[model samples]
Target: MTADRDLGSEARQMLAERTADLQAAEAANEALRRANAELRASRAALAASEARLRLALGAARMANWEWDPIADVVTGSEGREALYGRPPGSMRSAPEVLAAVHPEDRERCAATIRRAMERMPGEEEFDAVEFRVLHPDGSIRWLRSQGRITDRDPLTGRALRAAGVTFDITQRREAETRYRVLFDASPFAVIVIDQATFRILDVNTRACRDYGYSREEFLSLLITDIDVLGDEAAIRARGRAHKTGERTQEFEAVHRTRDGALRDVLVRVEGLDLGNGRVTYGAHIDITARKAAEVELRRSEERLRVALEAGGLGAWELDFSRRRTRWDARLAAILGRERVDAEVANEVLSRCLEPADLPAVQEAFRQAMATGGDFAAEFRILRPDGEHRWVRCWGRLLPDQHPGHRRMAGVVADVTEHRQAEERQLLFMREMDHRAKNILAVVQAALRLTPRHDADSYAAMVEGRVSALARAHTLLAENRWTGADLAALLRAELQPFLTAAPEAPEATRILLEGPALTVAPQSTQALGMALHELATNAMKYGALSTAGGHVALGWEVTGEALRLRWEERGGPPLAGPPPASGFGTRVIEATLERQLGGTVRRDWRPEGLVVEAMLPIGTIRAR
Candidate 1:
């Protein structure tokens, strides 16, 4: 019974141990199942992270690459082929990758990789390089690669593997090329300067030419060195302003060239942020010629002012469209108007013109406007004080820069004195012509009327009459041909024929009596001839035949007539009127009656012949 009980216990104990082992096995199976689920979740998370990294790399135009130095192999992500301008899976080895690099950059890239692979202990294994790659389309592209040794040989401590990223830098390189092209192609001088040190960093082709400096020389100079004023403080202030967000600054400054010649320039400074630091781009526009022209223009205007003032010239402008007239103070004075700054209405100027001159002036202006030609006009103006003045204007059309806009500018002057002088000269010419004709007519008449009984006597008579005319002309000329004094005329005609008596001088030989009256030029000629004939008769046969003889010529103005009597005494007496057809008597009658509108009568007196004449004052006297 003890043996059987021990066998049951052993069997139950064995069964419990088996049950424990099965439970432990079930527990281990559950743990294995849980671990499998966690491994699957971790794998999914890892896959999602890798996908994000690839997506990021693709978006950034970058690709992951690995280079194996020992095996001479190169491996890259999916987009690495495109970055290298190659077909998919074409770049498989280091030699192929090196062949893809540009011929100009292949050697440099090989050297860089070799150095990176031979890196020593405690030294950086980082490798970075920028190079050009050959594109399949016969174009070159820029690329940047950065990597480090991922694995190294323990014994040699040398690089065994490297991994990095490559990206497309073609766009950035092309942009830099375009910037350089524009920088050198500018017309105005362009200079690049370091903001902090005020040092000249670079210069364009124009800057080199304009400043008379070579490219090397320009690069060695400071910005302050070219400033003629050398105001370093001001330059620093401007730089500071630019650094503080001022995008642009402009000013006028004088700059010196390499030859030490100063130039006037308009400088425009623009701030550039080149990632490293702030720099300034200065564009200098030379304005030296413009400044000189402005100065010359001012001087020319001043010279014109002086000339105008000296010449007594008055400037005027007429705006046809606006119907307004503008004039300087000098012109206002000439027009007898108060000086005003504002333009006057055309009607105001027209009102100042004489009625007879307005039409002419208007027509001249109209023709000038119509033809776009020169304008010239001379007219009379009635001043406020009722004084008449003559004015002249000269003008020409202004340039026609704008179509349909007509303008003329010119000068005006008071020409009253000049006009008067011209009129005087004309009148003098006419008067001289008339006088010459009249004198010739008189001389011809005398020559025809003189008797030809003897050649000597006829010639003498003609000469005497001509002498009388010349004497009268002399008196007229002395009075500017306006008129001849009556008394002076009588004296000139009779003075040569007078002779002194025993007790009396030549002054008493003949008598002339008249008031201070002047005879018209025409009347003087006629009257002079008559007086000469009478005096010749007197000296030959009348009172003046003897030394003691005397003649009295007297006149008095009455009503509208001048009554004169020529009385002779103490010499030959006149028997009754001799032949009425004598040359001397005919001449006196013709002159006093036909020419002078007067009556001539002779009274035969016992003492001497007495002559009386009644002359119309209007016909003989000067007005």
Candidate 2:
């Protein structure tokens, strides 16, 4: 029984050991399966990465290639063969690929490879070359080749193979060529400046001519050397302000040339971040002519402003497209606006127009727009100060080729003062006509009262009286019918009858004296005519017939009355009185009594004849 129990125990121990061994084998197999799965995943990822790289190369118009130095085998990616316009993997060896290399670059390419191979193992090994390739279609392409020795012989010290990347850099090369052309041949002056030192880096041909400097001279100088027209600090500040962003900025500045001439230029600055350093590219456009034109335009505007102000004028523009109105400073002044930048609109102007005048204004605008007719309309505007003013607008159509919306521009002026003056003129004309008729009536009466028995006497007297009336009319005209200066009137009336000098009096001449006064227009003619009749009597028979004869005429203002005395001395002494008051006597009596509302009484003295007149001062206004 003890032996049987021991055998069972041994069998069970063996079974457990076998079971442990089986479990170990299963764990091992499980680990192997996981590792296989990971390997497959890694391979798939690598393939995907290579495909992505090729896609990237194609997108960039690039290629990748490899070469064996000993066997001279050429292998490349699909993108690599497309660089030379060939099928992928078509080339058999390095020489087969070299067949596409430009004849001039092939030898150099071979020499560069040989040199790279001669380097020692473990030495910094690299090969970089640029060469052109000829395609089957005969088109040329540029390629950039870069490589390094990947395998070398241990015993012979020979280059076995190289691992490299080659790319079709034709687009990049073409871009570089275009950049060079633009930099060298730009029309506006282009200057490249180093940001840190403000030193000139390069300049285009136009820059050299514009600045009056050679390329070498420009490159050697700093920005401060050329921007000589303004303060250096200011120019630097402007540049710094513009440099805050990479966007292109424009500014106007005066720059100095090599010959120290100042020139106005419009400068456009662009910031370039080239990774290694920052550079500023400036394009300078000569705007001296434009600046001069601007200055002249300002001067012209100033003159126009002065003229507009002086002429009480304002300028206006109606932009039909915008349904807006624009006005200048003069217009603002006319509108009584305080600000020059006052806003103007069609609605605002329309509201300013008087209700009655609006129709006329609208009709004028319509006519101008439809028929391109000259526009002249007078309207009334209520000023901001609540004063109404008359304004006349004159407009013309603006010539334009645009098919839609007409434009009219013109001037407006305040014609209030002019209108007032015109009214005054009309009043004066009517008064003149009335006064002229009255004088003609007085002349007719004088003629009728004259003696017809002596025809010659009548004619002589009429001529003389008419001449006196004409002289009075002349005085009124020169005074603008405002009033006649009393002294001036006397001088004018007696000028022809008297000698040149008044201080040196002559016999047979009339000498008159009076205080300075202004006679009313109404009284000037009457008083002038009265003086005429008295002087004519003295000339024919009284004091003025001989050189020794003389007349002394004087007047004085005495308490609401003008007492004037016309006295003759040393004349063919006047007989008592004219037989029957002659035409001259009637003229004197009618003018003084009826026209001036005064009386004329005569005092015939033995020495000469004295005519004393008493005139009411109330009729003659003093200015």
Best by TM-score: 2
How accurate locally, in lDDT, is each candidate? 0.86, 0.81
Residues 1-623 of candidate 1 have per-residue lDDT tens digits of 99999999999999999999999999999999999999999999999988998898888889999988778788988789898889988888878888889989999998988787677766765788889998889888899998988877789887787899899998999998899799889999999999888889999989999999998999998989998657779876754554524578887778999999999988888889999999988899999998889899999978987888888788877776778878888888898888869987878878989999999988998898888889999989999999999988899878866766667789888888899878966987898898798778878888887889999988888888888888888888888777888888888898887668877763588878779888987788888889999999988888888878899999989999988889999987566767655788888888899888899888878799889999999988887
What value does the lDDT take at residue 467 in candidate 2?
Answer: 76
lDDT of 1 at 417: 88
Per-residue lDDT of candidate 2, residues 1-623 (tens digit): 99999999999999999999999999999999999999999999999998999899888777666777667787777767777777777775877777778999999888887788778888746788889988888889999888888777889767777778888788888998899888888889998998788889989889988888999999899987878644557776776666546557778888889988889998999889989899988899999999999999999989988988888789988887778887777766777765435545688778777878899899888988888888899888877888788889999988889968778888998888888778869977997899889879867876887567789988887777777778888888898788888777777766666752244354337777888778888888877887777777776777776667777888889999888788888777555766677667777777788778888888777778888888888887644
Error of 1 at 361 (Å): 2.5
- What's the CA error at residue 561 for candidate 1, in Å? 36
Q: Give me the runs in candidate 1 sitting further than 4 Å from their true place.
A: 1-36, 66-75, 87-98, 105-130, 147-163, 174-229, 235-250, 257-261, 268-283, 316-357, 379-391, 414-623
Question: lDDT score of model 1?
Answer: 0.86
Candidate 1 is scored at a TM of: 0.53
Evaluate residue 132 in candidate 1 and report its C-alpha lDDT on the 0 to 100 scale.
Answer: 97
